[model samples]
Target: MNCWKTINISRDYGTLRLIMFSSSTVLLSFLFYYLVMSTIVQTTEFTQFGFVTVVLSLFGLVLTHKLLHCLPIWLFGGRAKIKISTRKLLFPLMDIKLREPLSRNVYLLALFSPLVFITTAGAVGSIMWPQFLPYFSILTSINFGLAFYDLVYASHLMKAPKQCYIEDHDEGFHILIKQAV
Candidate 1:
């Protein structure tokens, strides 16, 4: 099947909405760090290695997100495929495409697994490592900020018709609802 033939659902989701949504993600990420880290740790000092640690931590966070998103989708058998789309530029966008459409509930489960685990882990890490608060908060914010796109797609999917299935693309998703026979 030519995947290109499937409908690109992002067009209908509105640019303004996405912009606002993405901006909110970034704002919240920063605010969350400010609120949590500021109150708990008054000051933090970091050397050059701290910068390196932030970079590495970012890479790890993205990998963790991808792993969480991919594992559940792949669990649906071999119908799922992972592809890298350069359209995301330096971020290295990863898309999980499924040949078979899954139920809305299943898709939601796969989508949120990363957010749930990663956010919780970040909170715990931040609390445990007050000395490395900057690093931890930066890593947490980056993870959440980068996940803006995921939140967008999830927003669309959440409103999709019950029978519709979603196929993730780097840019957006294909919402497919089987036409009446």
Candidate 2:
């Protein structure tokens, strides 16, 4: 096997740029989600959570998003190591290290599962519980921001050869191709 490409999005795209993009995504998605939900629900009363509750809820959402990413991999019989740590002594970070290479399709599925699942849940929750639409919109927008990196990785994987495999490493992901004998 030979590595056809190595994609380190943070290194290639610059951390600042990625952060800016993610921030923009969060703001824009929140606006769009709230607008759509309000139009659909026609709710005059919106429930608000306390600051502590909101913070805890956001943390839970982040953990749920990470778990969703790992779910597809586990279902496909893939192994991954998950490490949880704190960044800046306050923010939590979860790093998922793949144990082996996966087919492009499988890797793509893993990448996208969180975004699809979380977004769908948020949408449905907003519809079913119209009074909590604001909370749902916030969580969904935050998840969208978190998913920006996955979207970037998936975009790169989409351009690789159909038979290629993806391996996650410290720097980023590697696209590998089998060499003909």
Candidate 3:
């Protein structure tokens, strides 16, 4: 599919639903990991150098995922920008917007970029270094949980009767419904 016109991003209806969906998914994943996965561990340590490195690298991976989405916008002739700030003790937000509505395929591809990168890399790393499965699994779960929301929102946009409008915001990017006129 293709996007034919410019669209405004909104924090309206569909977005709220996606936020709820994303939140619930993350919460469930965290709970499951804590209650189930954590208990399965046969070994424990307060801190380990290799694990710390893996943790930092995974954080880098997440940032890379965001950059992956942003960088492509410019390459594809769409303008993109980001603003970062924290609202509360735990509320850290990274907002991004593309000035142009990318093709549906591009948008969809971008949505899955993190998942593909994290999961694929983690799978390979885990196989090559079996001892790192715990770290890889933990990081992969986090990225997967987060990407769930974006996938839902992308799906909603793809099904929208109107074109999607994506614009920059002070906090998070807004996805707007295009007017018929």
C-alpha RMSD between model 1 and the true structure: 4.8
Q: Between 1 and 2, whose TM-score is larger? A: 2
Q: Provide the global lDDT of candidate 3 against the true structure.
A: 0.62
RMSD of each: 4.8, 2.2, 5.9
List ranges where model 3 is wrong by over 4 Å.
Answer: 1-58, 88-91, 160-181
Model 2 TM-score, all chains together:
0.92
**Which stretches of model 2 miss by more than 4 angstroms?**
1-12
Q: Residue 99 of model 2: what lDDT?
A: 92
lDDT by residue (tens digit), candidate 2, 1-181: 3435544433367889999999999999999999988998878888888999999999899889888888999999999867887877766689898899899999999889989999999999999999999899999999999999889888888888888888877777778876554
What is candidate 3's lDDT per residue for 124-163, written digit by digit as tens?
A: 6655555555666667667767788667657656765444
Q: Write the per-residue lDDT of candidate 1 for residues 1-181, one digit (tens) a residue.
A: 2232346765446778767776677678868775876697655654235567766777778778878887777776536666777885776776667677676667877778887787777777767766666666666676676677677668878887776777666476677776644
lDDT of predicted model 1? 0.70
Model 1 TM-score (2 dp): 0.72
| TM-score of every model versus the real structure | 0.72, 0.92, 0.62
Q: Extract clashing residue pairs from model 3.
A: 7-165, 8-165, 9-165, 9-174, 9-175, 9-176, 10-174, 10-175, 10-176
- The pairs that clash in candidate 1 are none
